[model samples]
Target: MMINSTQVSYFTLSAYFDTGLFKYLCFMIVMSLYVLIVGSNLLLVVVICMNRSLHEPMYLFLCSLFVNELVGSSGLFPFLLVQILSDSHTVSAPLCFLQIFCVHYYGAVEYLNLAVMSYDRYLAICYPLQYNTRMTYNKIATLIALTWLCPCCAMVVLMSLTSSLQLCRNTIYKVYCDTHSVVKLSCSDINVINVYGLIATFSTIFGSLLLILFSYVRILRVCFSGSKQTRQKAVSTCTPHLASLLNFSVGACFEVSQSRFNMSTLPNVLRIFLSLYFLTCPPLFNPVLYGLNLSKIRVIFKSLISNAA
Candidate 1:
């Protein structure tokens, strides 16, 4: 697949802004949100890295998860802020596809990370005796590499197919450049994109989801069989992860459904907010849930707060 600029040099993004004042207001809100998202996630990552106590497998995975949130949010927020501030929200062909790749790449990596995190928890709770042996440093590195690499490889192919597409239009009615939304502009039959998209979505999201569910089921079984103290400990460790996973899954579903299904009955404002939520909610809340809920992380965070105070 190669680039052909005969059809499109750029794409005009959503004209969601109404007036000058509204644009400025929206700009402030999005900029502040971006700062908070980046700050909070990076704070968690820094805390985990600096604290020797947090260098365990679970905390390491938490660190990776926070980093993923940062990566995902960074992909959207900066560009979004710029769009809100500008009078014309035109994104170049290459840049638009790059954004699509980054955004989706972030999402797929996140699913893989969450799946790996669940499996880590499963090992810790379900097979404590062999957890250390199985989740070695080299093995952990390999898992992390796969989580990032698989999505990159998938997105590369997906984007390649998309770039070669014969575009029929150059306007996307959304704030960000999504592969599917952009693909909808193509004059050519998008059966290729549709096919590969399904494969990529299934491999990244459903495959990971199934693994997570299996791990949790096994963890639940083991938790029930263990003593009262073991059950309490397992529950404490697993609860925050389950909460994060559920929130992320819901957000992902909303985004996917909005794209795949015709929800023209839904108001524009509602759809816009839902799309923003799809991008914003997971990154903003994941750190809050983990930082507040996990005992070790919570304690360490509190100690840092107290010393500063």
Candidate 2:
């Protein structure tokens, strides 16, 4: 596709809500989802914090996952929630950059956190004797800190590249600020750089996914080698992790498909769906996978209600 330098910026949103009834209904639906995601994740974090039993290395990872959900959803959902409510969906250049930064930053952080959690599980299951010694409280803290730092590095590279592009006045089509959307607006010939950036993005995400998969496979093999009780316990614990991994895998697949397809060929609805699959759904599911399935959480949740009463 050729770039038109004269266009500068396009500030238009599609007629997604031409019907007033549909508009109101969509607004209510989105508001409900935002409330649910934020409320559930916050509750998970609180439960982890208040329960002394939940202070172990495993629950610490759960807490981190909830935090990632909170950060990721907060970065993307509120702006989208507003857009759903209002008839006007126009966004400015500076605000667009802010949105892009927040989305990618939280997203990168979430990926890094998941990778760390995989490594934690690997240590606990594959190297039981060294698990406690290797994954001490301070060491876990260091892992979490490094996860945060990795995102900072990714943002530095992505933002620097995107910020330099001259977005010839083309506004984005998607509900949220996406990298592909922003890059498409650049007036200059960004084919080579954009391709390179997309490859780098995919490589990081796919590489992390591969690492997580490898860890889990090895974990399963180790568990199977143990006795029946140990195998069952490992399976029970891994069920939740597997659920999260599946959700992430589906989301990542959709994201890559959308990025690879020619925008003109893919319908707008599919584009929106793919974006939501990756950006919205995975964050919403993270807390549920890590928190609700645990017995400790069930006990803490019941106590919270009784105390409230």
Q: Give the top-scoring candidate (lDDT).
A: 1
Q: Model 2: per-residue lDDT, tens digit, 1-309?
A: 344654444344452445566767877877787788889989888888887888888788878877877777787778776777777787666667777777777766667667777878888878878888989999989978877776777677777787678766565666777677778767767876677677766766776788788888888788878778767766667778778767876886776666566665766667777777866787677767666677778778888889999
- How far off is residue 170 in model 1, in Å? 0.6
| Predicted structure 2: clash tally | 7
lDDT of 1 by residue, 76-133 (tens): 9888888878788899988898889878988898899999999999999888889899
lDDT of each: 0.86, 0.74
Q: How big is the RMSD of model 2?
A: 2.8
Off by over 4 Å in 1: 1-5
Instruction: Extract clashing residue pairs from model 2.
Output: 8-168, 8-169, 9-169, 9-170, 10-169, 10-170, 10-171
